[model samples]
Structures are given as C-alpha cells and as structure tokens.
Target: MKTKKVVVGALAAMLSLSVCSLAPAVAAGETVQISVGKVNAKAGETFSVDVSLADIPSTGIQCLDFAVTYDSKVLTIDKVEAGALVKNGADSKDASASLAPLFEGSVNSSEGWVSAAWSTSTDDASYWLKSDGVFCTITGKVASGVADGTVSDLKIVPINRETYSKSGVTNKEISCGYEKDGKPVKYATTLNNGSVTVGTIVTTTTQPPTNKIVRGDANCDGGVDMSDVVLIMQSLANPNKYGLDGSDSKHITAQGQANGDVDSDVKGITSNDALKIQKWLLKSISEL
Candidate 1:
C-alpha cells in the first residue's frame, strides 16, 4: 500500500510537470514585424517602396522604431525618410501604413520608422536603389502584427570585377526595398537591370584599358608605381604639345571616369615606372 501510494504521488508530479512543459510560453515585451514594400529601380530615377506596421504594446504603448540596411559597394545612401502614404493610385496619404512625411530619416530612425536616400549604380546599365522612409504617426498599433518595409544597399557595378580584391568578382546592388521586424511581405518590384556608361576616349594608338592600362594604380599590384610614370608619359608627352585640351583627358579617379591626359606629379617619366608597368603587363617595352 505504502509503495503504491509513493508511486502514485510520483506519477502525479510527473503529469503536472508534463502539462507545464506543454504550455506555450508567452513572448517578452516588444515584438517587431518587417516586410518588403517593393524592390526595384531604374538607373538615374527615383522610386518608392512601402512598409507598414501596427505598433501595439502590452504595457503602456510608447513608440516603435525601424530601419533598413544597404550595401556600400552598389549604393550611396543620400538620406532616410518617412512620409504619409496614400491609398493605391492616389496622390496622398490616407489610411494604409504611411502617415506623415519624414523627409529626414536614417537607417537608425528613432521611435517608429525612417527612410534613407542612397546614390545607386548600374551594374549593366540596369539598376536603381530606393527605400521607404520613417514618418510621424498618431497612434502605436503594433503587437498584433507588424507590417513595414526596409531600405537596403543597392549597387550598379561591373558584371565581374573585384570591388576590393583582384579575384573577387564585382557586382552592384542597384536598388532594393525590404522590411525588418514584423510579419514579412513583398511589394511587387524587381531591380537588377539598367546601367550607366561613363566612357572615355583613349588614344586610338594606345590599347584600350585592360588589366594592363590602369591609372593612379600603375603598379597593377594596385598601387602607384614607376610603371605608371611610363604610362602617364606615353599618354601625355608634353601636356602642352600633346594638344591636351586637358578636357580631352578625364580629371577622373574612377576607372571608367577617365577621359583625359593623365598627369602624374612624378614629373617626367622615370625608369622605375617602366618596371612596375612591366610587372603587370607580363612583358617589358624592350621585350615587346
């Protein structure tokens, strides 16, 4: 009898523990919902994506906060913003998600929402970057479910060039708009096309820019060197005599931004410049 009673007590305790284990644990205070308002843009154009949320609180409701991430390689954030969104096909903000205009917002928006403007690039002449901005609100309606879009990094870079590495292929994130925190959603849009071509006319006599024809970075190992001196010398023999409109050669620093006679401060072409260029060219002028 005693043994049976002990066994029964143990069974009861186990059953209680099991029941407690099966119960769902409540979530702590502060929930978040994020989604994609839209994701697409054309090079050199401005576009908008939407993000919505109902900020509610278990305790005394205060305010919510949100932000979108972006890539530096493909997009340059001009600013973050928030604004009152209007009904579809409408020109003003009325009743869905967007409420007020947040002309000044950032990836780190305070309170509830924000926006960011970024300079976008064309990977192949087809891409753009955009994002929803943070705006003012009259009420906090989240907790039930969150619905807001996020701005992110977009780039328009070459199809296959190293951004920071020689072997690392280069690609740009032109445009993108997604969400963070709450329930996830996607606005119908895509951005992975469009391009920007900054062209420069190299001397027809000189070979086009290749792994060999680089500026500023003459050594080819990715730095300034003597070989660069030779290239610069070859490019501009007597800036005055070369008839260098100065404008003919680009005052550029980016690869494609060049369209002018290269003027190195190294004075006249030096033998050291030749050595560096030869290293990158896999041959020397004497050998060629």
Candidate 2:
C-alpha cells in the first residue's frame, strides 16, 4: 500500500508540471476598445465608420477572430479594409515584418448583422505590432428610406474557445497572444461597442391652395357644365382673342386653365379637352 501511494503522488506532481509548462502566460490589465465614428448623411448618401482599437500594447498581438454586427435597416455595409495599426508596425524595423492580414465574413443587409473572422499567418502573427489606432474601416451607406432620428447600434463580438481551433490539428489553438518572455502570450481583453444616429431627411412637397379647385371647371363657375365647354372651345379657337374665358366678363384664372385640363396628362389644352368635359357632363364618360 505504501509503494502504490508513493507512485500515485509522483504521477500527480508530474501531471501538474506538464500543465504549467503547456499553459500560456497571461498579461494583466490589457484592454482593446472598439469605437465607431458618428456621421450625418442625406438620404441615398454613403458614409464610413471607423472601427478602431485604443490602448493596444506596443509589443503586439498574434492572432484575432472578431465580428461586428449592425442594424441593417438603418445602414448597409459597403466594404471593409485593414487599418494601419494591424497592417504595419510601431517602428520602421517592424514595418517589414511578416504581416499578412486576412478576413472572412458575410455582410447580411437583410438580417442586420455581419459575421467575420480576421487572422494572420502563424509566422506573421509572431511579428505583428500592436498600436493604438484603427484596426479596420467599415464603409456603409445609410438606407435611403430609413426615417429620421433612427439609431443603429454596432456591436463587437469575439468567438468562444471551445470551437476556436481544430484542437486535434496539431498546435492549432485560437489565440490573440502578446509577446512575453521570448514567447507568445495570451490574456483576456475588454471590448466596447459603438452606435450612430440618423439625422433629419429633407423632402420637397407641393401643397394645395387654401381652397381647392375643381377639375374641368374652365369658366371657374364652380362646376363642369356646358359653359365650361363653351369657354374651352372659345379658348382653343382663338387663344389670343378669346383667352380661356370666351368674350364673357369673367376671365379664366390660371387655376381655371389647369382645372380645364380634365385629361390631366399635362399635354396642354385643346378642342379634345373641351370635348372630354362635354362627354363627362353628358354622362357619356364616367370622368375626365
């Protein structure tokens, strides 16, 4: 019994040491904030949102897989591009480092989310620098029909660890490690999301007069009858002499001329317009 107990204690200590050696050391108090730029745009105009990271460690980060979701009803993503922070390095020496940044995601305008994965090659991850600038820029166009004062929230989400990497694929693990003790380091990060608000929409409208005018009332006598037809005929026969009022005392105003155009096709007035009004009055036609 003593021999068996001694062997069991020795194996437990060996296992403990193995875990310690394999586990990656964590850096304390590291933060990575995601912020978006606010903008005002007219309907059908395009704008850009900068997705930036603040307070990045100067040493650098190795790999990252993150996604941003947004309200598709208020905005639509046009394109996404890498920023200087992750594209280059802190110094000239690190500029030429093996930095290969790649992204894979789908922009769902209908579903209101963008699922993306960003990563660097293993070799590039080792030398990539960490800086306090934008990580990427997301250019989007405001939805043309979105009402004014609408708010769209943009969120950042990092994937979980269980499915992060192919656990059995030999040295595959999801990590955004920092440089530490001559090796890559791992740690927890704090993330912050952002949002944008829609501004007022400008529109042009033609308002009606205080008193509405009846269509086909050429003489402006408040009704479409034979007098209107007579006035229209007179106007068409001699626009200069008769002038939309026949030779009567009451002259057809501009509104009367417009109302006289019963066809409403904006084709201007003629004998046909007068004939149509006559047909409408006679019940030969339902309306002009």
Candidate 3:
C-alpha cells in the first residue's frame, strides 16, 4: 500500500509540473477571446454547447485551463470532449506521436461547475493549437422539471485557485499558455459567456396562405428542419454561393429570405433565424 501511494503521488506531481511549467509571460496588447455558444432545448432533452477560441495568437497555445459554471437546477453536465481545433492540432503532428494531450476534466454536479485542462506533454510548438475554432464541447441534459422559457447562464471562471496556488504559480487566471524565449507565457484573455434556453412546445392548427410567408421555411420546402438551418448559415457565410442573388441555382430566393426572417428585430435573415428554426425542430419552441 505504501508503494502504491508513492507511485500515485509521483504521478500527481508530474501532472502538476507539466501544467505549471508553461509560465504566464506578459503579453503585448494582443488578447484572445473564449466564447460559449448559445443553445435551446426542451426539458429532458440533451444539448451541446461549444467553447470556442477566437483571436488566437500567432505563436499559438501549448496549454489551456479553465472552469465553467452553469445552473445545476436546470441542467446536468454529462461530459466534455476535445473539439475540432484540438483534434486538428494533434493531426498536424507526427503520425507516430500520441494523439492525446495531457487532459483532465471533472464536474461538480452539486456545485454546477466543470473544470478542464489540456497541455502538450512537451514544449513542442508543433503540438500547440493554432487555429480559432472550438476548443471543447460540453454535452448536458436539461432537467426534466425545468420550466419552459427558463434560461441558464454559462460563464467562464478561474480554476480552483486555492488548489493551484499551492504550486507557487503567481497566475491562476483562465487563459491559454505558450512558451516565449524559453519561458512560459500567457495571453490577455476575454470571456464571452453564453446561455441555454428551455422553450415550451405549442401545437397549432392554423396555417398561412400559400402566398404568405412561412417563418423558418428558408428553402420553401413546406417545413423546417436541419436543412433550413444549414441553408441560412451557408447563405450568410458565403453569400456568393448561397445568397439570394448568387449565381448558384439553389441560392436563397426572396421568398426564402422573408420566411427565414424569424427574428423580426434583427432586420434581416441572420444566424438567429437559423437558431430559432433549430429550436423549433427540437420542439423546444412552438414556432420559429
């Protein structure tokens, strides 16, 4: 038992060293931003929120550690997995190299929070995440008893400071880490929080006239589904290929634009409309 304990202690110490070895160096005025995606779902339904990185530094990031807090009464975190950016970073490295980073994540259901950390096993910049994309995806299920229209906030927080401060690390702020001039460095980071909404399902028999606009029917396909969401996103992201006036035959039509304008306040068909259609499809909302 004593031998086993010693081995365990050694492993823990190694992990701590790996994470803290990348010290936080003062960055110029450049700042990186972390954002959580917004989502909507019905009670008892499973949903995913993406934590993305934007404004990634040219030097890239070798390590990341942060915590996210949510409303436990409304949802329970299932798991957090590596996102596309992390996977791409691994794929860019040598094929024989281990694909997995030194990662650790845990959830405190009672406290409604999750903490996660990831780092390359070595100081190699080739293994660092260099792109702006999803860093992780958090999957959760809405509480069965959650009321319709209920909204839960998801915010980034510093990792367990008291626990990490014991390592003699001067910085416990949530941010990405890299090495500069052989010293560990960190970037100025901005946190953009997100929210999840629980919407009520209402069934209706009324139908709009054939000539009238149908909300969320972006493709004019009589009904809304994942396709409409895709079309809207495509049209917005690449207007020349999918825009209303694009050369493509499948370009969005004027009628499609009118129908896809689910958010009247937004003035035009935007990603918000696509999101509303997605929620409607999930039965989270009664209408677009």
For model 1, give the 10-residue run with minimal summed lDDT.
137-146
TM of each candidate vs. truth: 0.22, 0.48, 0.60
Candidate lDDT values, in order: 0.27, 0.52, 0.66
What are the per-residue Cα lDDT tens digits for candidate 3 across 1-288?
Answer: 011122212222332333555434566886777777656678888777667776777777766777889999999999988765677554345342353335555678888888766665445676777766667778888899888989999998866543232454433456466655555566777887777788742222223224698888888899878988878765654454566665677777777777887975344555567778888899998866
Output the TM-score of candidate 1.
0.22
Once superposed on the true structure, which residue ranges of model 3 sit more than 4 Å away at CA? Answer: 1-24, 89-100, 162-171, 200-288
All models, RMSD in angstroms: 26.4, 26.8, 10.3
The alpha-carbon deviation from the true structure for residue 176 of candidate 2, after best TM-score superposition, in angstroms, is 3.4
- List, residue by residue over 18-50, the lDDT tens digit for candidate 1: 222342222344332223222333333333333
lDDT of 3 at 174: 62
TM-score ranking from best candidate downward:
3, 2, 1
Residue-pair clashes per prediction, in order, are: 83, 0, 2
Question: Model 3 — TM-score against the truth?
Answer: 0.60
In candidate 2, which residue pairs clash? none
Model 1 scores a C-alpha lDDT of 0.27
